[model samples]
Target: MAEKITIFAHVRNICKASIFRICPPCLAALSRILARFHSNTQRQLVLFLNTAHFLTIGVSLALVVAFFLYAVDGRPIKGEDSFASEESEEFLPNVREIVGEIRPGDSLSSSFRSNGVDEEVRESVISAFDGVMNFREMKPNDRYTLTLDNDGTLIKCLYESGPLEVHAIERTPEGSLAAKKLDVALDCRTVKLRGRIESSLFAALAAFKEDAKLVYTFADIFASKIDFNTETRFGDTFELVVEKYYKNNEFVGYGKILVARYNSKEVGPLEGFYFDQGGKSAYFDHRGYELGESFIRSPVPMARVSSGFSYNRRHPVLDIVRPHLGVDLAAPMGTPIMATSDGRVRFAGWKGGYGKQIILDHGGGYQTYYGHLSRFAN
Candidate 1:
């Protein structure tokens, strides 16, 4: 009687185990097979493995069901990728594009709210794109577009303030926002420009009815040869064959300066031609010597020099003669000061007479110092 009771228990356990994996008919068939096993070791081992295999099959089938439910919706899971990425595709179809420019008292959030966009979606776009673009950098008259689908759901956005600052933001089918920077379309033409400096190189470029961009390009070409800020005379002359960029018939900026000629009385006449061989592009002098300035001449190109770098110099404020290692620049208080060279900051903050200063270590014993700064750039 005890052995018969044990057989019934084994049969009941087998039926319960395979219930989910098999139908009721299959369970009954399995139960009839288990009733013949008794306590036979071979039959008992076979039944144990058979049930274990069905259990694995059960787990697999459950996973397949879950996969089918989600596979119908074709999208990467939310955590699978980041919010924004650089994309090459420029346009999307079946959408109505609403274009607008940023107004004086407008924000991205307020603009979206006025357009009836969902608050949750607007916040997601802001959060996703905040790292790519700063709210403070969004100036008045910056252009933006909203591409809505047939259902009036926002599918894409394009925003631009400058030639190189076009941002394309799009929403995926998964309701995730994707962002990318689009390249600007510009017409490049090699043009010749001739100008004479009346006050400074910057002023000369402005007087020529050209963008201030040409000043930097021309300066960069002859940076090592001449200091346009200090050495430039009123009669200094310049001629250049350069590439200028234009978008929609409006001047955007300047590109590569192919040929440059400068005749300054202090530095004499100097010429440089752009040469690109094998993938390296560089400026070459008339004698074919590569030209590049390792050091910038001035810390402030626009500011006038209040005092020169000197030894045994008379201090204006202290009324005492002392060694003044760094030059003094005359600029308005809180004016931005840029680094003359690239380096890691070895020191930043106050240093007594220097006030707020920054010391940059440019690898080798080459260290540059910026003194009396109003604030540090982030």
Candidate 2:
């Protein structure tokens, strides 16, 4: 009876374990039993290796697919290349053939249309001259010629007649475009000015009530050879005749001074004239001899008046009357100061109150002095 009871208990335990599905010890025992079913250990090791190999291959394939996608879609970064060819063919410049006169009141569009120009070419030509020429003001009988390309583009536009010369450019092969140029041709003119001396050069020039421009012209022409303040006597007089330029009744610029006559109260009258010798223009005396004066009177060379001539002005050290003999030409420093006449340097060194002076001995008791010099001329 006890043996029978043990068998029944074993059967009951197995049924309970199966029903609950929780048999840790049984499962462990089953593993051992299954391990025994394999004939060799090598087979178990082979199974382990197969599982690891599949995992590695799957991960590798995923990485390869990611890399492939990146390579196919990614773009490289490049720098700006201004010299590269443009992609748009529409941006290319157009050159066309044009013959006939473009006049005021003429339709640029209709005219080009009559000439069998393409719509694109006509639009391009009109756009090129849009802000430049007034196409609405064009008159009949006006002569003009244009050469265009298949696209009806203009390369050059020219209008001949009147005070200005016009040149218009529409297209270029390179990436550069230029606006048209209007070269002006002004008429020539004559100008004159007169003045009387009173104590100084600029004061006398101001008395003329002439245009400041005219005075500047007069001074520039004569400054190289004449010293207005010292060399000019108290009762001197100056007269000048010159040539100027005008465009459309407007003053453009001044030319050469035709003639100048200066009469000094003490010094003899000096007459100067401009002459073209061997293709070079120069100021010469009435006798046709070159005025070989060493330097121009004013450093500015323009006709502006000098500041003043003061003796007791202000000596940093002395601070008293030093008797400033020559006039003070308030010009930009380093301006050239020329000798009045051809003479030897009597004294070219520092004088007590003169700072730095150059005294020229004209001989026979005549002498001229220049002080506070930046340098000495050779």
Candidate 3:
């Protein structure tokens, strides 16, 4: 009953809600129309709508739809229910709005239950927004609003997660809930994050509470030129410009890192800028060279390189001089192994001296070989 206009849930919220009275004779005729309109509906509360029409382009006639009735909130004539003798609430419709932020570790079902939303209504809302969004995927502080009638009939449900995940459910003409994914109007602003590396990049960004993914991405921009572990000095600093998304003045999340710069005392300063070349997206150095080197420096961090790549090397088990093609990294016995980059597994199993090995083909004729006593993902 919030937006009792020609459209369901939307247009009337923008326009002002005004009340005007109709004559007794006109109301009697209007009640008959309402009776026919709600023959199948069983709700005792009756709500009447008001619609206004405007002129179209290139039309001279000024036509106005005048019903002299803003909106009605009265008991239905044929319904077997009752209303209080006091008619003070008869003019205004009863609409209760529930708005809340989804806190961390809080389920939508639990939040709904806490907010006086019925269990049946919660189930129906979840069913309506199933494919549109899984409630489990909604991030902390994501918002939702529910509009219900006096008797707790759901009029509208709005769930907002991000720029692409705005969803709504509204009561249709037939009184069934219909769900739809809405296009969001987003504001993208360039943001800056700067930090001095006292130790690792992760430690530097810990104060800002930035995600590890962003740290990995920021380091990848300088992966080819600078080996962060070996080259980073005590006073090295970094800064970057990133895009942050917002909806209706509320922040959503981070977007692309547009520009990044790393200032090192040893390696000097280097800058990388994001660019869209042709249809592909990649980062470019300040002098217009593509910084497309995406190789992970070391599969195991803080692990010493026991053996470096060499043309001729001693075979440890065989006691002979041969070509050692791969660099061997040594860490603790239970140290977890991680893939250097994304790839499809070409082989996984025992491979002679390689033993319990997994070979990943990273396209472009580049393949990484992981060997020795360790388990790998399928």
Give me the runs in candidate 1 sitting further than 4 Å from their true place: 1-107, 114-116, 127-140, 149-152, 171-178, 277-279, 331-344, 362-365
The whole-model lDDT of each prediction reads 0.76, 0.63, 0.74
lDDT of candidate 2?
A: 0.63
Q: How do the candidates rank by TM-score, highest first?
A: 1, 3, 2
lDDT of 1 by residue, 275-367 (tens): 899998999998989876566666555567888889999988899998999888897786566566678999999999889889999888899
Q: Runs in model 2 with CA error above 4 Å?
A: 1-182, 198-209, 231-235, 298-327, 331-378
Assess candidate 3 and give its lDDT. Answer: 0.74
- The residue-by-residue lDDT of candidate 2 on 114-215, one tens digit each, is 767668756766676777776645656655566655554455655433335464654577734344757677798887877777675566666754445555
Candidate 3 collision pairs = none
TM-score of each: 0.62, 0.38, 0.51
Q: Could you tell me the TM-score of candidate 2?
A: 0.38
Worst 10 residues of 1 by lDDT: 82-91
